[model samples]
Target chain A: MAADETAPAPRGKVTITEIARRAGVSVPTVSRVVNGRSDVSPATRARVEDLLRLHGYRKRSAALPSRAALLDLVFNDLDSPWAVEIIRGVEEAAHAAGAGTVVSAIHGRSGDAGEWMRNLRARASDGVILVTSALEPPLHEQLRILGVPLVVVDPMGSPAFDTPTIGAANWSGGLAATEHLLSLGHRRIGLIAGPPRLLCSRARFDGYRAALEAAGVAIDASLVVPGDFHPESGFTGCNTLLDLPEPPTALFAASDQMALGAIEALRRRGLRVPEDMSVVGFDDLPEVRWSAPPLTTIRQPLADMGQLAVRTVLRLARGERPDSPRVELGTELVVRASTAPPAPVL
Target chain B: MAADETAPAPRGKVTITEIARRAGVSVPTVSRVVNGRSDVSPATRARVEDLLRLHGYRKRSAALPSRAALLDLVFNDLDSPWAVEIIRGVEEAAHAAGAGTVVSAIHGRSGDAGEWMRNLRARASDGVILVTSALEPPLHEQLRILGVPLVVVDPMGSPAFDTPTIGAANWSGGLAATEHLLSLGHRRIGLIAGPPRLLCSRARFDGYRAALEAAGVAIDASLVVPGDFHPESGFTGCNTLLDLPEPPTALFAASDQMALGAIEALRRRGLRVPEDMSVVGFDDLPEVRWSAPPLTTIRQPLADMGQLAVRTVLRLARGERPDSPRVELGTELVVRASTAPPAPVL
Candidate 1:
């Protein structure tokens, strides 16, 4: 729906009355949508939401009573240890702030949005921290109407300019990992890349390319295989790269799980890590150090990111602007037994 | 405080008036404590709680409004991947039941009880599922006063008789793991035991002894090592075993993490798994299957136990008695590349 009236207030300062007038809805109807009441019809709710977004209306700070004493942490899925690390950080921070933390998983399925929204309303959570989940406009609009502060951790795509986001320096991490392998006299390096849809994944891949260019090594497109940041994909991707006419002497995986999976694949082929093929991985998860060949990977501060997200969202809930909208923590290279000079050619 | 009257109604059927009179507090004061209000003095709160427990007070079925749409999941600490597996199950089950899950970590500190109780009251959660956290009497009394349903998962010790609990057949799992080693012709086996405080740990240790007794083999105290169910202990324990004049041919660790640590220690000693010394672990965690030697472990249905705990607590929240107050799921032995017949004497 388009605005009915001429330009009124500046973006993010429009009044609720103007929004309702533009949407052709009664003030109470707009109020019902804001309160997450079920009495409003879907069509009117959608139209009102559109007007709210179109006008960039912002709820006045301190408009409502003190927010609920609970914070919500949303995820696409809760199957990985990576998530657990984040949860630990969020839980600790929230507890320290005297707020309970409600965790919800949307399962990345089509119908999960409605269920998730309902749960959000039911809990009346004060703030939200979404980890690597999409931020569709409709969902954003609903959250805005409820005046719930939100922060994104490792956002799936580029987050809204105004939304606070916390992420690791994936590009620099990828570059450092690839450079480490190159410094060890490895010219032919295969890459197991994460899904291209994620901005972080893209950055990592670009960093890999940039590192290769800096080293004067020709980029072999066939050596780079696609992965979903999961072990299974890593396994298959490694196998695919291994079958090439001339395989890479070393490998870099975008994630530690993928690196482990690649190692497994090499083992099946009767090859050993570092001795037969060197490997580097990102996200130095806790258990990687204990892996047969201690993993040499990038150390992404996952728990710290989670903790920062909670603190940022809580600050926003208190009507305070964060120092910055986006924060990228540094990643470090941890040298372990996984990387070594390529074995002498027979 | 003991009940004042000689005999009132049967246990769990006492009236609020009686409890107030017994505790020498006003009716509204008792109500405040019951509803988790902060107005009641700490001394009064404790007194009222004792009386409530003494009379075995039970809130009538359907007395409260349809309970809050949130369930609390508390853990002593959320450090291990094992906790993540349980969390996944609880989150899934709670979501399916249209309830949000609030996760809290008490960190197993001395003063965490008050903080945890405050968080629980703030959320007004409908039920609680405590995972491997001590259920001290004072904390139990507070929960009882609030009338919140509770289910214990992997209780640290034997759970209170009336409290519903979900656990695996630890003793049987331990027995089966030991027997597997024996059947593989490993006459001399070492044991890496978990903490002595937990009932599950004690049972596993007992099972190991039972297996050896059944096989007509004498227990060797020197072959047993104590571990806190962590990798560090396992590493040190393995080193201790290797220092023995005659180290056992096979080893069984009480937990998967401990088993992985033992493997690392053996690796440092230039010993190969199964070929040099066979190893078996408990809790077939997901990552174990991808470990260097693909660990042979006892599968302890951790996720299933978590799911069952949520279901049981929800049932109790609805004022329905569960099928049983305690449930122990079965465990199975998973043979991977980590175990084999003991190597013949050189």
Candidate 2:
């Protein structure tokens, strides 16, 4: 370390000019690296990156390059309507911010991250809003080195401590859904839990357990079944609970898709929703309201979370600290026709 | 017009240098006008635009401006699952081609077009795919002047004949749906038509009439009702049909959302689908498969259309003529549980 140079350096927020001065390069060279151009040498790129990290340099909101402002939104897959809701939210908010939204689905968790990264580097995106957890650690570091602002929506696990994240109140949503069922006088409530790997899913499961314990109802290990948050898993989970020696009268699915699946499963067994069995779902997606027996659900503000992600990322891009780095939007329980009092015990 | 300069102009695509020479301006000035940069004087912009339009200047597939390749997808509104399906398709195809997709909803037909246009001008988008007919002729002309490639998906009314468009076989879908009901021994089939303003909707309605004619079933005008292709309209249309002195045995809704609405209306009236009144829908959106008595409907190749739009726009951007200026993909009838032989006349 150059002690004299370090002593003269500002305490925080170094500019490209200062970085270039320290790296013995021109201002344009620093600009090229900052803009993610391919012309920089590997050694120089490394040195600049080290200094950038050391100084925590954040590019101030200078006049953007001649190109349009773009916000990249990445997802693991775009197959579900859930993804659509988030896209709508992000698109709306990004548009409001005078930024175009670039949407990408990386197929699976991590397989296409490299391709996406290459594309990201190729484009001068203003910021990145990650709606999926597929990107690995090195990519995150690369983004940081590039000085790109990032906001994660519904982060799967413990993201970097400083990474700003937006998510629904999964735990509270789960608890409220279960509590709604309990209030309807159902003691034996089947729990269709989302994938255990996801933090949101785990939080929801914890909420379900908390609700059950709060009501002084014994947790029946046999009644809880795991799901991957798809309708197929929900169907399978519902059947698993139904085949048990003692079946719960009402069931709560961690996702609307799963709830729809569970309802279909019950239908196949010649049972009626709310009559033969009561069902509750999470993520009150639009179509669920028109669902047969109209689903009772926990409404995750998916679009709001998406909108907030864009706002937070833009704030970071402007070199402003957000009031909260991690925000969990409140979730609410919506009672429709799906849940009802348990049928008179035989 | 500069006659002496015009004499030597190329007969086909003009280069930016040639345009600059003809316009008596710097190459960068003409380039700015082409790139939608607002810095150029209005008078200079008009002169450059006229020369470019006269010469049919197309930005050749040279190295793009060092920004990410982006294909803009615009819709009147992003409220429907139909939009989501299309978005998924476009996003997938754009990803495959190493291009990013920028999605925007103009809100209504034309309310937000100016804002979108401003954003579009501020960005270096490679191509545009219009999913709505909202953008007016002036905007279209502006996009043309900017040399941005354009494609239309499910265009409403008659778009400019030169504009390449992608759509589903709406007439065939409608014909097939109505014929299926006729084959199911139901002579009285209600038709829930989409807004007549859209050409696709008109085509579907025409096919419905043609099917009835082919079956020698006099089309009862009273049985057909107009809808805005929403669930609420479908519900209202279904109720209207049911109140007739002689109600139809089955109904075909123009879109899946309307079909869901119709089903909900029936549920409210305590009428079971298929057993009481058979129902069919258009646009077999993904979630409809999980709908109660899973909707039997015509499946519009929405995603396929979206994918084709991306390919077509990219091709136009490359200055290649597509095989067809207007292409309609086939729509197939998916026979699920919603349609069955109408219950024996009581």
**Model-by-model DockQ, in order:** 0.38, 0.52
Over A23-106, each residue of candidate 1 has an lDDT whose tens digit, in order, gives: 887877887776668999999988887776555455432222222378899988887769988999999999889888888788
Return the clash pairs for model 1, or none: none
Q: Write the per-residue lDDT of candidate 1 for residues B160-224, one digit (tens) a residue.
A: 54789899999999999999999999998999999999999999999999999999999999999
Error of 1 at B345 (Å): 2.3
- The TM-score of candidate 2 is 0.91
Tell me how far the alpha carbon of residue B165 in candidate 2 is from the true structure, in angstroms, after superposition: 0.9
Q: Model 2, B1-346: lDDT tens per residue? A: 5467555354234688899988999998988887778899999999999887666565542333344578899987777788888988999899889899888888874657887887886665778999956678888887888767789999897786478989889999999999999999999999999988899899999999999999999989999998998899999999999999999999999999999999999999999998999999999999998999789999999999999999998888766788899899999999999988989866
The whole-model C-alpha lDDT of candidate 2 against the native structure comes to: 0.86
